[model samples]
Target: MHWNWQQEDWPHFAYNASALRSAEDAFLKGGGIIVGILHHVDVEARQALAIELISQEAVDSSAIEGELLDRASVQSSLARQLGLSADRRKANAAEAGAAELMADLYRSYQAPLSDKLLFDWHAMLMNGRRDLADVGRYRTHADPMQIVSGPLQAPRVHFEAPPSDRVAAEMERFIEWFNATASDAARPLPAITRAGVAHLWFETIHPFEDGNGRLGRAIAEKALAQSLKAPTLTALAETIHRHRKDYYAALHRASQDNRIDDWLAWFADIVTAAQARTTARVRFLIEKTRMLDRLRDQLNPRQEKALLRMFAEGVDGFAGGLSAQNYRTITDAAPATATRDLAGLVEMGALVRSGELRYARYHLALSN
Candidate 1:
């Protein structure tokens, strides 16, 4: 017999609560620290981080679907959604739609989950990509829906969702449980775990033809925001991106089997890791402010831009740390000017240069 959540006989689809106790505690502790950090950061820093985190969530979520979006474009769209100014070009339709819908979901964090909201999100996700065929409405055809890979002739079916006919009812049941979190009833699933459950359950339903994966993740984000009672960006997509294989493997496993303990555990860990990242981000901004104060008088605008790039992008900031060549690229300076700026920065101890002659590279000298 085939397996799926539709065939499961669990109690209200609730899994073992004992399994998540430690995870719940850890998430709460980390979440509280992040919330406090959110309150502590100045509005400018908070908004900047919010812009970056939300852009990550949008871009990374689409990336999980093998869709590469421009980070700058998404950030611009998010800024527009937040009613902030984005000097960058308005994002293309795909980025704009994702940014708009995600912003709506986050802003309306307190609104009850419903079919209309889901449909709207679907529309936003496919606004530009679909352009004409009316994709987000629903999968009207009764064709087979399977996630396949490799050549079409010898396709590997990872999993197949329930028939399109059954999607509506399945989604209704899921939404009921989701909205119930707001009430004072004895909820079967805890608020923290609900995000994971929603993620799994909705993905299983495979409600939309194109944006199920992205929208499912968005739903998880919404549940998370509601649970924490704050819209501080979680950037869960960053974790998902790092563990893309494991993420898909767990989802496929849960789709094939009714037992979801392992799946929920993986998602819980992702949430905890995301919280730690949020904390690190807040502290990073704090450090940058202090560091700039210490070195402000010692650096020029172009040099400062190059220095901040390292802090902003972290590992992806620059491969082998700051270099004369990289600094020139970052600051749009000539080689002679770049060399002079970098040498001056090293003299002021703002950066530490290493390597020999032409091979010399530089890194942040942010040590005591």
Candidate 2:
């Protein structure tokens, strides 16, 4: 069976832009809202929002590749990289590398794509790895790069990239197309359309031997950032991770043909959803700051520690809200102390308590 790269049309993708009209409009609208809200927030809140979104993207993108990174470590690394106050905890190589790659993307979104840039990204992603023969470069092996599953003797080939010998030439053409279709290009494609096609095209090429999924997502993000003329901070990878099965299915179906109307529509929904989530995050950060300002110096050390821990859970908050036991665990406070601190928080409007007595759960008063 021929992969999309083997088709006669090859890299020339075809899609109906009209079908994505609503989604495209919604994404742009959401972006505007995010930008406006961010503008009103103070510098500290803005920084916190960026660190949270970027950390989520790094961790989620790696998770899509079956790599479970420590979120706290990634966040700490990003906070340090962005010159914010950071935790004393050290980041491991993988966590540090992901954070570095994400920070670089945020800083260099406006730059044109190039072989050197992609190579540098690959190298950053592969840091501390001793197994790969190729790092910071395209695969040089002669074997066919196939994504497969099931038993080794009876495997199902979901997709196969072009042979290693063709990678250099293929990547050259891909880079040219990417740069040529920039938002400022004479005839640029629509924002979400370009991002969707770029992701599919890059994944079809599967340029690197590893980290292709993560890098492909990054490339898509770059396309969006270029269109917006700023870092997107859209939590795209997190959204995709949440719908990983559908994401893979969409890619598999689109990879078999040049017609990607379905993929574009699906991807547009994903982007718009991610943007909505991001907008919520921006608002959440704003509310968090306001809440802290309102309650500044009102709490004891245990309450302060517990509240900060809950906020670290971000827009999702605690799974079932923060229980008394959970608060005690976070602040190392005794049961009686945890109960008093929680009740005080509720009384102070810092937390909203629900249920009754032993069944009570405390959630942040901020809009989730």
Instruction: Mark the 10 consecutive residues where model 1 has the least summed lDDT.
Output: 182-191
- The digit string of per-residue lDDT tens for model 1 on 1-368 reads 36575575621454687989898788767778877866766888888888888888888898998888898998988898899988777688888988888789779977888988888998888886743344756665587678889997999988888888877777888888888764243464555588888888888778887788998888888887777777747878888888999999888887766677888888888888887777777767766677788898878899889888888775344577776778888899998998899888888877788897789998777532
Q: Candidate 1: what lDDT?
A: 0.79
Q: TM-scores across all candidates?
A: 0.90, 0.94
| Candidate 1 wrong stretches, greater than 4 Å | 6-14, 131-136, 182-188, 331-340, 343-349, 352-360, 365-368
Candidate 2 per-residue C-alpha lDDT over 150-185 given as tens digits, one digit per residue, 9 for 90 to 100: 998999999999888898999899888888888788
Best by lDDT, which number?
2
Clashing pairs in 2: none
